[model samples]
Target: MNGTEEIGCCGAYCGTCREYLKTCKGCKPGYLDGSRDQSRAKCRMKKCCLTRGHITCGDCGEYESCETIQSFLSHPGYKYGKYRQALEFIRAHGHAAFLNAAKHWTNAYGRYPEQDP
Candidate 1:
């Protein structure tokens, strides 16, 4: 993670989101690059991770049953369940491996297909 690689705390690749290209830079602290948009800044998952000192929700013990997480996962935007999948990948492997998986992931808008997640 170069610190600007927009991978959200929930594991959704912000890089693949159209809104991210237009606004966000990645998941670094807001002061680092000021890339977090209003929505990103308000994200519950992000808040949870930051408060818990975690880089992602995969590091949380309650991720699977978390109501906040489940609610976010139910959003219609992720019809493909990419967030859930990415979290699973991160937990099973690691953030680096999850990033590698995101590099090859073609389902999410294909924004950074050439970059290493």
Candidate 2:
């Protein structure tokens, strides 16, 4: 793990996303590779957090009301409930702790073993 996997700015676990090793390196690079959806590189949620100098929206003071994050989470295509769980865990336990726990679970394609059926 590159240690960048657990801290996706909008709360998804890059370590567990199919794009992690192939197309994306998570929000920290601002989706620099452009292999996923090209528009994802311009994600408002990631841009908002980075522009504010935050590691993740969970680190932000206004995370709850941040329209960008709220909209992302509300998208019907957003199926990762673990994203919210990861955010809460990060907020309560810290990023390092989340990373350590996540390390045991990420599969090659980047989805957790238990999550993929």
Candidate 3:
């Protein structure tokens, strides 16, 4: 599938997620369809995006300063820089570019070498 289908509203590359397809679908679909994964179902970022009629935070005007996204990214459990990088990439290059670059990602989280700061 095109990697866009696996992009999360919170900027995660679900395509590389260990649980993707096994226990979870990508964030957008899972959020829309009422995911069985409780975490996905209850995701604030997903809820916010859907509520705002946005596919992802990249579509929001407040992306950079959004408290919800900031809270999510800063959560200790989600200390990966890749998530932020993905969102920044989306903002700078658009989803297609992010997806194309992310196609080779092997890990669900963590900075891709090519995107390392």
Candidate 4:
């Protein structure tokens, strides 16, 4: 599958994840694989997206106000900021553009400059 398909519902890039292709196979696929106990199975975002038939939270009308995503993005951990940034990027540019810019992302989470409006 392409890199866009590897992005998690929570905006994590599975392509840059260490567990990807080892213990997991991206968010949707890993959750559906069902052969092993994948972490995505227990992911709240993943379940919510699948239930709503959305590839990512960016597809949701309530993306900006959703409690689940807000909670995740507000975690004390710094890494969650990157997830929030990713979601914002998706909202502004679309998944294809996000994936293209994300190709240079070294960590599973990091900053990407916002596009000029």
RMSD list, candidates in order? 5.7, 6.6, 4.1, 3.0
Which 10 consecutive residues of model 1 have the lowest summed lDDT? Answer: 108-117
Best-matching candidate per TM-score: 4
**Which residue ranges in model 1 land beyond 4 Å of their true spot?**
1-5, 16-22, 25-27, 31-40, 76-80, 105-117
lDDT of each: 0.64, 0.64, 0.72, 0.77
Error of 2 at 70 (Å): 1.9
| Per-prediction TM-score | 0.66, 0.67, 0.75, 0.81
Which candidate model has the greater lDDT, 2 or 3? 3
Q: Where is model 3 more than 4 Å wrong at Cα?
A: 30-40, 76-79, 110-117
- Residue 54 in model 4: lDDT: 76
Q: Give the number of the best model, judged by lDDT.
A: 4
**Candidate 2 wrongly placed segments (more than 4 Å):** 16-18, 30-41, 107-117
Rank list by TM-score = 4, 3, 2, 1
The residue-by-residue lDDT of candidate 3 on 11-93, one tens digit each, is 88788778887877566665555554535457788778777877678779998789889877777665346677778778877
For model 4, residues 28-75, the per-residue Cα lDDT tens digits are 774554654544367788778767877789789988789998888899
Q: Write the per-residue lDDT of candidate 1 for residues 50-80, one digit (tens) a residue.
A: 6776777877999878889878877887543
Candidate 2 residue 46 Cα shift, in angstroms, is 0.8
lDDT score of residue 11 within candidate 1: 72
Candidate 3, which ten residues in sequence have the lowest lDDT sum?
108-117
